[model samples]
Target: MSRLTDLIARTKGNDPQLGADLEREFKALSSRLPYGLNFERHSPEAVELPLRPVRKGDKVRVLPERGSTKKGDQRLWQVKAIQKAKKLADLELLGPAKTETQSVALDDLVVVAEFRDTIYPGLVSTGKVERGGDKPFHTVINGENYHALKALTYAYRGKVDAIYIDPPYNSGAKDWKYNNDYVESDDLYRHSKWLAMMERRLLLAKDLLNPAESVLIVTIDEKEYLRLGLLLEQLFSYATIQMVSSQINPKGVSRGGSFRRSDEYLYFVMFGTARPCRMPLSSEWSTSTQSDLENSSEDGSPVTPDWTSMMRRGSEAYRNDRPSMFYPIYADPITRKISAVGAALPNGEHAAPPKKGLVAILPIRKDGSEGRWQIGASELESRIKQGRVRLGRSTSYGFVVNYLPDGAYADVISEKFLIQGYADDGSVIAFSEAGDLSRVASTQWKIASHNASENGSSLLATLLPKRKFPFPKSLYAVEDALRFFVLEKKDAVVLDFFSGSGTTAHAVMRLNRQDQGKRRCISITNNEVAADEQKALREQFLRPGDADWEKYGICDFITKPRVKAAITGKTPEGGSIKGDYKFTDEFPIADGFEENAEFFTLTYEAKSAVNHNLAYARIAPLLWLRAGAQGLRIDKLPPEGWALVNTYGLLTEVDAAAPFINAVRQAKALRVAYIVTDDDRRFQAIAQQLPRAVEPVRLYESYLTNFSFSNGE
Candidate 1:
């Protein structure tokens, strides 16, 4: 007997109650560690598990290789009894035919269970578009995003500058799927499933981000924002995290008996010194009027238009609230200018009058309530000496007090008062005591331009014509979010995994067009069919696995077409519907877009091929992508007799080694060369002959290790 069985038997004989309690505890713990017995699935060891004896009551399935099998033969079975000595078991057919039993060898049975990862890493190039130029080409990858991310890790690990993803919100209207089936609201572990899906992909994505200067932006609604926030915090503990509430829908969506939902959230996870740039305010808030004074010194000037309020208001504006700011100001009765200031006393009273000849001014509201001044007694004294404080018109009590103009005191006063005076041109004149004018960004964001369901749909419809995808993100919204980081780093690399309808890529293109920069984007998405399309396909007997199903799916039908139209300035029908951009004032809106991009699909290579005999063609595009997709093909040497890939080249033929070395020495741009040869002596010979600037690497020897993976079972 096994150790557990023997222990149970001993416990039962000693004390029946103890044995029952121990057995119950063991059963509960066993359920928690269900995958422990299948250690081979989780182990990192290179070897496979050896054959082992089947346990009684263990679930199994018959091998599909067995000939002449009945319809029910493929179903799961239970091991009723196992003869340890013979290595055979009495299997009772499960499900409909539970009464029947058959004696089968243990080798013919396999465990029926779930494992963490099912797909292997491999990439198959479906097609390519060669719009040759100095412009960087963007890539749209079609596959399961997880596997695509894994494949990309071999090439782009620690190199991406930014990643913006809009994952499924898990609203439970048959929107997202797990194991090829929609995860309905009634599912007991729906939330767990959503987390599991996001966790796996996010972990892979973490590997691709540049450790020192990268940012990850994730957008989510109320359904899973809390859980996702905690998850991001857990995974990225070393990074600085900030959450912003974005109003994507100002009108708001009505929920049952609850407040209308008008906002979603953005989690900006910054690594190292990555930060958002101070962008120019929106058009409505951009206009500003400069002061007329020129050549003013840093110190306060006599003719400076800058001024500030003398009285304080709001919550902490009372004398009892901040007694230090409630002192009295002495003004010259003849000049109507502040002459002296009194300090605050220990008993919450003002100090003795500065001079008996000057008039004392106290802060009092129109309702006869005591109030505080904007500055403390010491600051008031300094301003009085500089002639910054002056008396104004008399109140109903026939008393003159200090006052500042609406334009000059706007920054110190309430924003409501500033808006009242500057509402004509949306322009405000903010002056400093040093006589300088500066622009400040407003905290309040306008929500009209960020309507996702409406603006996003209209943007995609302009390119796609059919509205193929559901509820995409607003083009300007994503552009605005990325603009914070990409504004200065125009050549930065951006990635999007949940690239529904490819709005993120479209935004990147628009931003580059506006700035005349060479930014590159990489978008990954799965070809999952939409809910309505899936229902229609099922009605037509064309399920998910059917040969023609993928042709009608989102990645191919929606994402690829949208990206193509946006790049080439023409619709899929070969007609031009392109117009000028509207968002920028620097460029004409009617100039149209002139950009380039390529499309690719992910596929897997056999484990044997990747390990023993990997070919250059299988991994060339990956190299090209890593090189910023500068050129389309790596098949032939350039006209200069050497192929150039971002200052790197691979010399395939031994006969071309001399020419490659000569090219390396002649071309000032070349920095690295990969010599492809099986003979180590020949590789070293070429490596030694290369210039000091050019570093030679042996193909399939130096780089293949990065692409290796576990057995693709």
Candidate 2:
């Protein structure tokens, strides 16, 4: 029988209850220890009968494996010693802290069970390869696509810097999908499902950011904007929120209802640091144009103006000088400050060329024939053909070109389109109809306004051509708002988890591409929705293929297969698309209290088995050994030529002159800690022999700090 079984049998004879209690304690203790030691029973009735035999050197698995350590903490223990009933068998486990051990009843303690041949199993070796160097440069890619967002989050946990997403307007359209299906009906669970989806990703996403960094920026309409805002508060407690307004279609009211509502609102949330220190607020605002850069005529001061003032005042001149640049802008029906657009102009749309105030008409041919110029036509044509055309200014004015021929440029550009308008009755009402050209447009956007840019429709068409993506945002409005936060040259990392059509990425790329900045971005997206319902009815269209579309759309590249095409920048099949940025997926093991722990063990010298009642008698042998080994100087000797350890576990000072101080007054013996309870004679004898010997301290002083000896000698 095992030692525990024998102990139990002995105890049961005297106190059956104590034996049962001891057995129960032992079982519970075993379960809590690490390793696979389970307790099985052939019969619950005869509990203490036959315990499978346990030999002295029987090998038994003990403790579980200790996983990786956290960033700054150290591993505490390699094995743990657990003591069960005082009489039962004791075991030492070599494994992780808080590991469990299963136990089988004596009757069923499978003697043939496998034993641990290896001391520590399942531990990760340090030789395992990592992704890159110990330190690596990280970057973030922003875009309004969801699948990409999910993929990135899954791939890189605890590595992202920012997360900015602006979802659909939720205008009763089939935009967002749930569970690989569309949210058709006003299903009460629809919103909840969306929240749950976000929750799943966010729970994982939260682990992705470093403790020092945070997430930022998620735009939404009022329909579900408030709900999203609250959700953000719950998810990211350290987030700071703000609403930015962007002019959609300057000429509001496209659906033709009452007053046109064009202004749109974007909800932005910044995470990590309390707030970005020294973030350029001007970048969030519209960038300055050429006209804005001109010096003030009054004092040669820079005549920089806000976007609205600049646009309104410069509208006339913008239209007259560059009629092709005119486009309508929209606003929100409720708040005039919020533009109908998602902010930022669409891709490939030409911005209004910086106004130079100088205007030059194509010189009419001398014969009144088109393209038949009089003097410098031949020279200009030759230059144009060679793509080096530079029309020379008049000899009177060096290289100066003028529209007003005044001092310096002012804030507003003259609006020729609106300046030369007439009513249907053939009556010119241009000046009268013209409102405050310098007044800032309403925060709420209008759909049916005349301040539309010439490329407005085309730009919108390029982004949301067939109105496939409901209430798609204008790139300009988003850019304008981003200007308030995103800087041009700084190493900013932008994130957008709720990417729609990859707009945020497009914007980030455009910003850097325009300025040649090295700003990086990260975008997360889940492919749960469809691009269109007609093709995949009730089916998920936002799948891996959709992500591929975006990736291929940008650079016509697929990172996975490009390794084979590295030399030629072509796939094995001779495909042209080749990805430059390496893409990878990762599953990182994170650190947490519940996930890992620190365990410990206690050790001391053991003496021959003897029922000794004296406190010092029970512990003196071990104390003496430690003192001799550690060379603790003291003047003491117990009755048996050893140091006495009192019941209190502390050493009694032999010298009355200095009770606390331990000094060597004897040549044969040394000072040591107190012993087990009850040996007074030994204490006195040691005191007589050695003058200043005191009880020794505990082994793990870092753990047991308050231990003391009670034999007050």
Candidate 3:
């Protein structure tokens, strides 16, 4: 045997417990299967490609090599076969020369797929709501969330305080799509494809979260919760993970035989010391408290008294079930004060009898049935020592046991004490000496206000009379979930990549309006039409490439309109639907959320040889958006293509470097300057002239490189 193995064997002989553990571990390792999570008939070599090479029947173009072809020599070719052994691909030439076949090196070809706005990763402002002041403006991006997330990494990487996403739950009702097709329930690899999509986006999202002070909240249903939990655990191993069951649908959806589904879950993966804020309990809970506890003391201090029934009422209340909890409590009969707690013996006998004039308090129900105490003998003794346990008059029956409210003397209650059956209203319940009841929010969130789907649809229907979107989350739910984390962080930046129906942005606006705080939201979603809608559009001779087709998709039709109506209190046709608030009694609906939001669509620059050859027109708007869209004027271009926006000077050409620096010197308070140039020497020379407060950033070299992707022509 090897030395290490021999030593372990010897150690096992000497220490059997440790040895057994090692033996079991070794057996577990030996018994493990070679592969895990096998998908039937799926082969990595046959199906999966990391870089996604052009396959048979794919349209492609020959990329011109240096000094090899004329400027317009490239032509579209249809791929026939990729011969891996020979590193060559068979291609058939298109357009008039239909029968021409040729073999070319793999490196000489590029896929000819149309470029998605997200794939290009540049922002083009479509419209804006001018607040006409220094108010924070929210952003809504109309593009694929994946590309939008990638673009955001350039500007908001490690800067966002929180990310809340309600991704498609992959329920089999054509709720979501993959590769432009709805993944049905029968699709064997549906789970795998969902995981693959989520993994890519989540990795990018992890970079955007501030590791020291952020939390990532993802909502999911029963279909993929187990797989998603494992994925979250794998990716965020360092975070403090918690899974909360949120009641979004009180009226359960019936599925015969199986349990009716009523609740979805929120996976809160918190990094560092991030925690939820405390919230006040509903007035119903406060009114239910005993009236005597609300009375003041002789010195005018609020008199706080804790109370609990002497008898245990649940399944484990029998003396035989928990003999340790069937202990005796000795109290002075006249004073009605607990003097000592007596332990129960192994034979279910009392350790000692009560002294003269002292009566033993046995746990007895109203029907005189034998029962056990709420706490064990050790805990009873601890409470007695702290002068918390007392014999008091019962409102329902005879003399009963009472105790001080846990943490009654402290200014605020700890979360641990609240978890011990303190209140039935919610997870974390707290009671103050002034008879005030508050809820200390924790991982276990079971609030009735966070109903899953109906409220969301109702709110949307109120905003846009006849329009409908499937399975939207309640706005109050999102607002409450964020209120737990960002209540104190008024200026925090919140991002939601899967921004369906724009609920997260609406929640943020509501929060800001309620608290008069400035919190900005960035929402990104795709403009893809539903499967049935796409079919209908195609039947009407409308194609995906047509602008009219896109107007009917989720981003343009649902997300944008919902956000606009929410902020403006007017429908898409400019009709006011403002009246009483349907969900809450606190505010009128017509008060209208006073906020500003800018809408932008993702666009791409023309394909170029050098990575940094992107034009100034494309890079300028992105800079404006990243700087919070302050004073953005896309209609007018400055003389030298250099403009001062907010606190930054954006120079598109190095030739305008002298004028840009002169302008920066003129405005001595410039915080930073972004210079777009391909030449390194020019960037350095211009950067040297800027003041110390003005940090210089090379647009193409530094900023743009972060978002550069391999677009196959």
Candidate 4:
């Protein structure tokens, strides 16, 4: 038996209840631990209730006295009876072992569930914005993010490249919700509830990321940075994690007798081979330390160049080891250019007769010992023509020779070597750029565009007139953060669950416009009304499901409109936005984006209510996203047995495989083939018939199939 099983058997001798309890506790603890050790999870315990109206026989946990300092009951209770007139409910303790009762106000008890509920996830299209091209539309899903994440796992499991989120900071204001109720600073369990909410959502988000190479970027402020860091550390213990301090507020927000708040923290959680890609330094670094650099050790020594001495050093430098490597490099002492390369001399023979017009540089050690060149005469001749072989400083014998080997040459062209100014000799000068987190002395990101007031709020006002969405992220700040991960990844599928004003998508669109990348962004947010808006709506007897209330939601009013405006170059008022995005890349907002976007709202569909053909329309978006989310989407089910689009092909019926195969072979742009079937034999045979370049995805009767994304086209 396993260790846990053995322990349970030994403990169940006198009481089986104790053993059952031990088993349940062990599994929960093991989920959080590295090796399922006995260390109990370190957390503030609290019960998170579901969002539903109170009903008879519903399990619940009574809320702690609101605005009171005391903690509330953490145990589950079943509603025994409800008095509608009194707005009170009688509750009995859950579980057969405990018999307890209480009567609480209806507002205090929130209906909860002890068992996991089933949900038939579906997407309903709300709108679309197009630039009249074949670009795969970036998507914005308007719903509670948790459910949206759940639905994404089915379509994009292990396919996402990066996830960047700027969730609510949980800063004691009612900026966020827990089980449909706004969690305020005065609530004693606010931190625990926030943690619980984030924990659930992040766990789901984890499924969507490619475990082999993906990054998770989360932005937070001072209020919850410490707790958020600990939570991430606990979840991703095996991955590399880091934090960055970005200055969003230059002047800083002041509190009585406290230091001004100037910065927020960003946690970058990298899994597998994922890491931050370096870029040309512009303004991500602070200039305040300029004078300090002059006084520092960096000014004391000159950095070494990648090109090494042609004379072999350290390993096998002698002529006897390799006689062919002992050749002469012919270069002019005045012009410092290679004139010719001389053949190697016999093993122990003396120097060959001198050649006129150029100085012959022989390999000589610093201690005056005979050494060999790194390469032979034949290779040296080819390298000299390509500028890889060059002349170095004059030695006592002659001008020393240097050469860039194949590996160093590869690094230069691949941008590992940062090109500095060249020397007088015309040798390409380059320096090293850091690939470490500790390269900077301080953690502050004092970028000018990161200023929240100017770039975030004011810039947002240009596209959206009079819409009040608090604390939207700076466009360039999100762009800079995303650029490090996805700049090189042209088709990276990025996701943002807490998309407030759609800045994440806007950032991605800007990135695409600059480099013409095919990167797609998926953003999820709820259409929640602001606190003041809720009060106003309630006064007019308009609740949440009302059309008037829904129209003013954050998704409908702010996120969707902002995305459309940013992409179409027109504000909500149908006028061109009058400003240029300044930082990293500069372009007028009126230039717009050559991109496409679609909007969706999450809907829970009952399988009993819909047939297979009708359900296909709901999941068409998923199939489009799975097929690289590029080119024209096969947006509907194949009307005539097969659907052939730019990026992928789909076969709806088995009998049409021959024509489908012919079409797929002809379309050079098609990279994926979706074959719908129930039989394993049919799927295998159909997949084998496809061209070598096309990846086959099999979708079965229940929508469960091998969703394979062949890494790249």
Which candidate has the top score in TM-score? 3
Query: How well is each residue in 438-462 modelled by candidate 3, as lDDT tens digits?
Result: 3444445556667656568877888
* Model 1, residue pairs in steric clash: 122-603, 124-603, 580-589, 580-590
Tell me each candidate's TM-score: 0.66, 0.33, 0.70, 0.68
How large is the C-alpha RMSD of every model relative to the true structure?
11.4, 26.8, 11.5, 10.5
Taken over the whole model, the C-alpha lDDT of each candidate is 0.66, 0.34, 0.68, 0.75
Per-prediction backbone clash count: 4, 142, 2, 1
Off by over 4 Å in 2: 1-159, 202-205, 209-215, 253-259, 272-457, 460-471, 524-713
Candidate closer to the true structure by lDDT (higher is better), 1 or 2:
1
Highest-lDDT candidate = 4
* Cα lDDT for residue 219, candidate 4: 97
Model 4 TM? 0.68
lDDT of 2 by residue, 1-713 (tens): 38987898899898776787677666655554253222232111100101123332333322121221111111112112222343233333333445644442222121111110111101111111112121111222222233223223322445555556565445555766543245654765555555555544565456555546554556554466666666666666666665655555566655446667555565556655523332212211223344333322233232222211112231233333333223322222222211211122233443322224332232122343222121133333342332221222232211211121111112222332133442232222222122222222222333222122422333333323233333434444444345445543344555555544444544454455345454444433332324443233213322222443333321112111111122122333554432222111111111100110111011111111222222233233223223321222122333332232222123333343133223334223434434322355544454454434433333222011211110011
> Candidate 2 — worst ten consecutive residues by lDDT sum?
591-600
Model 4 alpha-carbon drift over 4 Å, by segment: 1-26, 30-115, 283-442, 607-611, 705-713
* Candidate 2 residue-wise lDDT at 356: 40
**After TM-score superposition, what is the CA distance of residue 696 in candidate 2 from its true location, in Å?**
43
For residue 685, model 4's alpha carbon misses the true position, in angstroms, by: 2.2
